[model samples]
Target: MNKIISAHPVGAGLKIFQNDPEIKIHDDVLYIPRIPGPHDSNYGIYDSYGRLVQTAGPRRGWPNFSLGQSQSSSISPSSSYPRATENSYFYGGHIGTHFGHFLTETLPRFWCAPHWYLNKKIICHSGDTIEKLFSVSWIKEIFEMIGLVKEQFIIFDRPTTVISLLIPGASFEENHFSHRQFAEFCNKLGRKYAIDLGISDPIFLSREKFKSAMRTIEGEEEITSILRNKGFRIVYPETLSIREQMGLFCSDRLTSGFVGSAFHNSIFCSSPRGLALCYGNSYSTNFWLMDQVNDANIQYFSTPTLLLKNSPRVGVPAEFTVDNPMDVANLVIDYYEEKSVLKKENEKINYGKKEGPYLIKTKFNSFLQIDRQLGKIHAGSGVGPRIHKIFAYVFDSQWIELFTLGGDVLSMDQLDSVSDTLNFKMQISQNEKTFSLKHPVTSRFVSTTPDGVVECNREYARAWEQFLLISANQN
Candidate 1:
């Protein structure tokens, strides 16, 4: 384990540190030796006075201290390392070719580049070539956005020493936390790059085209179809240019999709808008961090899924199926479509009136019915002429409590309404035909599991969880 060192704080989002003082370079310029790898044991950075720069070293608590470990440390360069030829900015450490990492972790350090180093070169320790970097159109566009050109990048493939190596502290950290300066930089880009082409249609960013389906949701096609039917333009973000992608997300419109790197494009939103994310079994805090800066109205829907141990996709280590596609779709539709309108509608519902001896239907095409013998609720196969399928919602001062109904009266156990299991807060659909139910107690949705067991245990409401109330009393 390498000893952790402290870096001198120069300003907000700026730190200076040193390591391995033996190979010294003169003046305030730090000598960032060729980092063979994090485990090389000798590679490090040093200040003018030979003090170690802590920022260049491994941060404690990272697994094997491998946040930025060099995967190709053993591969030596074909030629000798380039000598110190010209002045350059130190753009070393945590540099990568990954799009997501470049957007969040790597590009942030260069936020100050245009102001100070417009004429200077950027010295990077990564062995990747400029040609490969340029091959990624979005990466090249991002460079142009920051007033940087490919000519300014110096790929340090071998050991080299230089003078006055200006090292800037990272504006954003690994855990998705970013400095105020970084947020300001992003907002400035949002304003500069945001183009208004008069397009405000709701967009569903689909990752179905990506070759690597990491964390891909199974039954995503079914969900996409539902969104498409609701007038959401199904957008495959990879097919669009960086500018086009930015233009769509940066606008003040409803944006939604499966939670992944493609969604990270929301960082460029000049103005906050309605954003919905459908998640599999797992979730990422990166979106939450982006929300802290963007302030968009974001809603999350969880699709109950069983993680596949042997995923079919080539690069995907894990993938999950949407346990109830209809349920998931309804949750998203309710959020993007009816959230604002339903707020007013909810205020008008007279909880005391006879809402129903209602037949509750789920997106699964199943009817919510009681299984008295099991003392639990289950989604029945169809809306047959069964008394258990008929139910009523009773509001107990605050929450909409559900109870099994026998004939026209509410079912009773020991004289009181028998509602020990079902409780909800309802959001009526725009057409008043369907309703989304949220548990008043657990704050989850009433959903029918894959096996037909009904429970108010979903984090977000979906079609399987949404109830279409057919009031028997209504003519």
Candidate 2:
């Protein structure tokens, strides 16, 4: 059997030093070329007689030597082989180290999208304080649930991004003591894990841009009073934007807020380990929108908070009072710990399942709700032809035709005219099979025959029912 020997200096050049002087030495180390597949470089180094020795790499770095031999004849090494040093070899970086950087960079980018949309792109509405509270809690819960603890490496085989929300004017000044306590808590955790607490800067809203909104609420005085009462230092609004304001909440690994704010969106998207505390009140609109923005498989923890109240004449705001901050804190802690439990439950429920149909159902539900609201279809006589035109513009041609022609609404002449112009028609045969207009619209029509139509509808309904069941099972 052939063996690799360490290179030693023989005069001006290097030579391999073998215990058996009869073994020829190469330039530096001996080389055995053309080894069979499935055999390592060190293979066949020993024989049954216990003769050959195998040494790999340079003498300084790879000093260890071993022997392996078979019962058959021993092989010799080539004299022209060159020695390899430790520096010449390539080794990959540690998975944990790579993951840490990925979480730091990509997490922030994902979370910042919602903030970018609200503060820079959309100008339809401004966010509120209650929303901020809910968002903070949600983010904290999601992080804990995902098991994003310090020093632990999470490998994401697929491409993924994080999304978080950052409230514009939320402050930790009133919770200064809590902030300090949290910082200490993080420090302790860091020490135990032998990891560093790498906290990023806070994202806040631009105070100058929202001067009118800020002034209307006498925000400065109210915020200062609340902070002082909560034993936190008073923070000025003008100092940062909403994105920056989120820095305070994320001072620790744990943080939370409502589902609606751009700040919350940014944080949720950016956090490597993110939690989202969703108030049931905002689930219909804001939370749904958040789900669209993040796409991070966000773990939602429900908080028992009222979003709206009903009255006979005019609607009034729900009570915004909290009796105990400690209770809220305890809830936040418990939520994070429960994230793993929820994730395991989710895996068990969704195991061996396909996700495509569920995604389609979610999209359909959104389309249906928006269409009903915008078309005033549920408002009795209030809806007119103009609303139908608007709906046509809002929904894709396929969806418009699907809802319009599949229902009894086709009896109306106006809808027929619209369908004709749109080059779409929905017809039910004697066998109860549905067919679409010929050509381009056929693909959009979902089903073109009675049995197919029934089957398609049943499939969609069954998929939707399964989705609901999965959701219920998760809860």
Candidate 3:
């Protein structure tokens, strides 16, 4: 897998490791061909296994701007420091600019995206009293849920695991990570947190007295009054706690807000009938909010603000009133009317709640995950292989389906199956605490082959046949 990209090393004398690296290494130390800066996050040191080789002292994006404190030293990039101890793991990530950062950039990097190497511990910038950065709570909940709360997380200001992981940021490389996969993780967490904290009244996201008040709507009071008079309870989302905030928004069916961080909370809301957004010309992009809101079956309507060119300030909707107020009000009214009709129909169908027969929830082995499995259903045409685990879902017809983990379900075959063996009965052993999966058509139990092939050719269930039905869903 190694090809010498360049015949000469940039430095005096160094040996090329593999691929066509930016530089060469020599001795016990790797004399970097290019000297990096203090805040250069692009530095990467890798092993043969493709894992990032960690270095001591400050990582790139530290002093978490939110935390206002970093353990990184004041040493210059030219000075020599102790290399990261062999096998020493760490927690690392980015200090993103906005709410969209948490949804699209931050959490995905931490939990769902590929890093220099896999890290169990995480570092966060916490704030219990502060009004900004709702990230710490989300980080904590994730660590706790993943069974990593014991020693897997570290916060800049708070006490947790104080290690640093050598992971690259999105800027260092392309984020081939799946957005849909990240959304599923959020959905799972939203459901669990929502269940813990009871749901609340329909929320009207108000930025009237919020910190980022510049981007607020023109005549916001009138707009808010229109919503309040209808049914929305004007809510300042930043004032409340994370769990409480999630519960309030997740439970509501209809919502409206001037496009900003407050409205980004719609990430927790699942399958809503309609969501209204008002934005200024300067605030052209909804950021990752568009992905979350539109994905939830929420009917979206925008009141576009247009004004004179070269306006220095952004999100000032009041300065220009290009769109008619009556038109905006009509759209809002029409949306609510549709929302009302949809809610009743949903009630009749019991639409939102997922009903299933199989109970697939538990703690899986650390290095191995049987909680979810994906392999060649068949190596023949139309069958496939995947990077992530395959998911199982129960349809309205009460049949089990093998769904794609990170790819399109339809593009890959959504294999529907009904195990006819023993009428879908599993040989669950209480003494051993193991269960075996049986293939109905073959009548043999599912077994792992030496070649990593999932086969049902075994006559009797053995160690490979036994499986753990661990119940952790990324939604």
lDDT of each: 0.56, 0.25, 0.39
The runs of at least 3 residues in candidate 3 whose Cα sits more than 4 Å from the true structure, single-residue gaps closed, are 1-79, 112-178, 195-202, 269-273, 280-294, 304-310, 313-327, 339-475
- Candidate 1 has a TM-score of 0.58
Q: What is the Cα root-mean-square deviation between model 1 and the actual structure?
A: 17.6
Query: What is the clash tally of candidate 1?
Result: 13
lDDT of 3 by residue, 1-475 (tens): 1111111101111111112112112122211111222233222232322223332112222111212222232222321433433343433344333444555445544333333334444433322212233245664554455344434443333111212334433211111112344445556666776542342445567666665524434455665677677665777767777666555546545665555555545555555433545342112223322343236544433353323233535444334343445445445555666532322111012223343323332222211212213233321112223333444443342223333444332211111122211122246656657666443322345555433444444557777666554343433
Model 3 worst lDDT run, 10 consecutive residues: 4-13
Q: Per-residue lDDT for 1-475 in model 2, tens only?
A: 1111111111111112112111112122222221323323332222223233222111111112222223232343332323232111111111111212222212222222232222221100111222332244433332343333222222222111111211221111110101122223222322332222144422212222233311121122332343345433433433443233434343434433323232233322322233343333113222222232233234444433322233223233222323333343334444445533332211011123222111111212221111223221211112343433112211221211223322323121111111221332222233432222211211112221211111111112222211111121232
Clashes of each: 13, 69, 8
Measured by TM-score, the strongest candidate is: 1
Q: Which candidate number would show the highest lDDT if scored against the true structure?
A: 1
For model 2, state the Cα shift of residue 189 in Å. 31
Candidate 1 residues lying further than 4 Å off, grouped into runs, are 1-52, 56-83, 87-94, 196-198, 274-282, 304-316, 339-475
When 2 and 3 are scored with lDDT, the better candidate is 3
lDDT of 1 by residue, 1-475 (tens): 1111111111111121122112212333333444433244334454434455555533322112434434233323322434567754545444556667777766766656475557778766443567877777887888888888888887655455564566666655544345556656777886788655465678777767776535656777887898889887888877777777666667667777776677667777744564444443224445545655566556554443423545455555466666666665665676676643322223223457544456676777677665454334577664444426546564532345556554233322111113344455776766666677754322445666666766544665566656676664661
By lDDT, the better pick of 1 and 2 is: 1
